[model samples]
Target chain A: MSVLLDPFAYSFMVRGFWVATLIGVTCGLLSCFVILKGWSLLGDALSHAVVPGVVVSHLMAWPLVVGAFISGMLAAVGIGGLRKLSGLKGDTSIGIMFTAFFAVGMLLISAFPSMLSLTTILFGNLLGIAPHDALQLLVISLFCIGVIALRWKDLLLFTFDEQQTIGQGLSVRGLQLLMLALIALVAVAALQAVGAILVMAMLITPGATAFLLTRRFPAMLLYAALLGGGLAFGGVYLSYFLDVSAGGVVVLLQFIVFFPILLCSPRGMGWLCSARGGVR
Target chain B: MRTPSLRGLALTANNGSIAVDIQHLSVGYSNGVIALDDVSAQLPSGAICAVLGANGGGKSTLCKALMGIQRPHRGSVRLFGGAVNRMLKRNTIAYVPQSDDIDWDFPVSVQDVVMMGRQGQMNWLRIPSRDDKRRVAQSLERVGMQAVARRQIGELSGGQKKRVFIARALAQHARLMLLDEPFTGVDMTTENDLLDILREERNAGTTIMVVTHNLSSVPDYSDQVMMLNRRVIACGPTAHTFTATHLGNTFGGVVNELLKVTGAVAGEGNVAMSRSQLPEYPQ
Candidate 1:
């Protein structure tokens, strides 16, 4: 308890709290869109796709988030374009693109082994976050949420049916590109707070859990945001006490929370399984 | 700049002005597989136009072109005598794709699905207004989906799910409604009710185009019919062009072979009933 309080007393802890809060709220929102569209793999792909950018940035001592955003957007374009052109399924394309991107990133790391260590890459350090990085996170978080808030219905319609939306005269291609851009922004914003591996958990788990528990779109988003924020905050405190990896603890807690909902929710996997069994 | 105006002409019982005017429209996949070629048609407003064809015909592709989902390699499509610009597409045209295209496990409710239609009308940041909610309810009632408005869309039966999508399209109050196989998985009553709602929309001056395989009902119900097989094989009144000659010509030889194969498998009859195989086209 005393050690946990020690981190909060410093300015870094306050900034860390804000970063987690924003990541939770923002990631939660995007996660709902991803999960609903059956694009959870996209969340994973976007996170891993940022590896090249992160690796190169760290290698050159350049800004990490900038590299991550560029790489993530490129991954989105590559994956989406290939799927459209080849008519292969979304997951297969995402898998192909991310594995290749991640492998290239890893090769880059191997080539410049001394530039970055594992801890900074896999799980971010709160102490190492400059005040400037924290501020950037805040601005990016606000901007991403604003865009989401603005295009809520358009995004929902486009996710549901690109054809229907296009018929209505909306620019289906434009909305898709905008959504991918936002998704890229989200992946980059989360890099410093939760790192590449755990960011997906933040983006997907909360939304999936909320989807299980609710039917209304607005309520689902609200539940996801709260779930995300709580897990992120709780994970930090848990790590403080356990002296373990903060991001790992956070995502584990998310799954831990998500399990009960999956089982107990009226529309959850558990209920679905039970109904399917009875029918059989 | 791309539209033609031919209103107020005593135009052979055409009923209303052209809702969908396409001239020399051609569509093909990137692989160069042609879907439509030099297809020209005018779907009059206030008419139930049934697009009829065998599998892999251009029925759905024609719908896509008219709805702006895909652009024609040649020619142009005009809706309501105006060139279709990006901004007006949302309000002027409403589309319903096949039900099977959706993931049944997606976590959205019937009302949420219906409300998506309003996204075209509302600003991105603003919440749906009172009028939007009322329109949603009205549309649900139109499709008899009001009872399951709160239910998850995935939980609905195939027929009920189609009704929900119909309700969504209705909520948009679109000038032209294009439905691709709305009758596919639905029961007879649901199909009747759907046709009734479309008729009501047509009565209220909305042009309705439907792509369907349920050939028995097309002649009796549709005001006009367009028979397609990668091209405009024929287009006219349901009663006239729906003859066996046109159908055999429209479907080509491959379909006749399929009918013979199915006849042997099902043991329905020996002659294979050319009339049954033809599947009476819409007018």
Candidate 2:
């Protein structure tokens, strides 16, 4: 009990826990859309592409988030434009753009050398998150949650059937742009919780895990949020006890939880067994 | 501009009876290949139009253009005397794109999928009201899918999937419905059931345009036939318009051979109905 409660007693641990949980919920919600739309690579692409933005903004005294948002959105739009203009498939476009952006980020970091620690940028320094950053995450998390809650049906329609959305006179393009913007915002908000390299885990693994567990969309979302928040909070506590990297532990724990669920979940391999048993 | 004005005139000249009006419509891909070229047609309300052509005949493109899913390079499409977007906002047009174009693996219930049809009629926040749920249920029941309303969409059979989409269009209560290949992959019973539903809707004064390759059933299922090969080859009543000449024009030289084979197979009564056996037209 002491080991369990000891981490919460520290202020930084409390802030770290809150940030992780908030980011878990946000990323958890987004994971469903990302996995459903097969945007996992795009999420990874945008996450890494924002590193140079963070470095340049810190150097120029601008809000790091503004620069991060611009770069992330630029990466997303660039991937889409490249795919459309060059007639390349989505994965190829993602590969070309994300690698280019990531290389640029690596070059910028080496050139500057003073723009934050590479380890901290790649693998987030969750233990050192300031209250201001935590507050920012909270606000962004709330906004994302609010938007999803208010326009869930519209978003679902747009995501599920884009042609029907356009046929129904809905703004599919606007919804797509909004989704890209949200991805950037959530990526920036999650940067301190999980960093760029492993942020894709939080943005995809949770929803994928929940998808295997639940059959309905709302239930999938609910399960994802709960699973993500619970596992993330648990990872934070474990990292404190083990004195290991918090982001690494969080992402590792998520994957650890994912594998077993992938096999046993009713929507997963278990489905095969049930089908053979003549039970659906 | 001239085309739109002529379409408007035709709309009034037809005594406001035209449900879909396409004037000089042309759609092209980025590779400079034209999908639809200078195609024009005016279809009346309460009629079933079957768009028949070999694969790559721009049938889907014509449907997409009518639904405003694809932008036309030169020409205009009007639905019931209004622009496509405006008519769509009024919930006057419902479209069922090809089932292959749909993401069937999406995590949604049949009920929820049908409810999406009501989105165009809902308020900005787009919450499904009680009436919307009732209508969705009614639509599902009409399509014989009420029992499986709670089932995940992915769990449905191909025919059931098609019916669910048709139910979505039914839920919209749109004045004009565009269905692309709704009969593909469906069982015979499901096809008959869908034809019944379509006929019922037509009796209620709804305009329906179905993109299909099953030419044999055109006379039975559709009131009008529009044979197309990148452009209109023939357009008129089903019995008169689906002539061998038009089919040959739409499908090229092989269609004449197909007609001879079809005549012999018609007596044997085991004719293969697969579109794969049909002759492929050169693009």
For each candidate, the alpha-carbon lDDT, in order, equals 0.76, 0.81
**Chain A TM-score by candidate, in order:** 0.89, 0.94
Q: In model 1, what are the clashing residue pairs, if there are any?
A: A168-B89, A168-B90, A169-B89, A169-B90, B224-B283, B225-B282, B225-B283, B237-B283, B238-B283
lDDT of 2 by residue, A1-280 (tens): 6766999899999999988988888889888888988888888888888887888777887877888888888898899899889988889999999889878877888888887788878888888987876787788889998888887777788888887887678888788888888888888877777888888999999999999888789998898898888888989999998999889898899899999887777667775556464334
For model 1, the DockQ equals 0.51
lDDT of 2 at A183: 84
lDDT of 1: 0.76
lDDT of 1 at B97: 79
For model 1 the local lDDT of residue A262 reads 82
Tens digits of per-residue lDDT for model 2, B54-148: 78889878877876778899999998899987787777778887788888767898988898899878888987788988999899999999999
Give all TM-scores, in the order shown.
0.86, 0.91
Clashing pairs for model 2 are none
Please give, for residues B1-283, the per-residue lDDT of candidate 1 as tens digits.
2111111112315574677787888998877789888988887777778787877788878777766667789988888887767426548878887987876666679998888777767764648899999999999988878888888787888799898889888888888888888778689899889877877787777878888765666654577778887778878655555555555656666544554554522223222122344433233
Residue-pair clashes per prediction, in order, are 9, 0
DockQ of every candidate structure: 0.51, 0.64
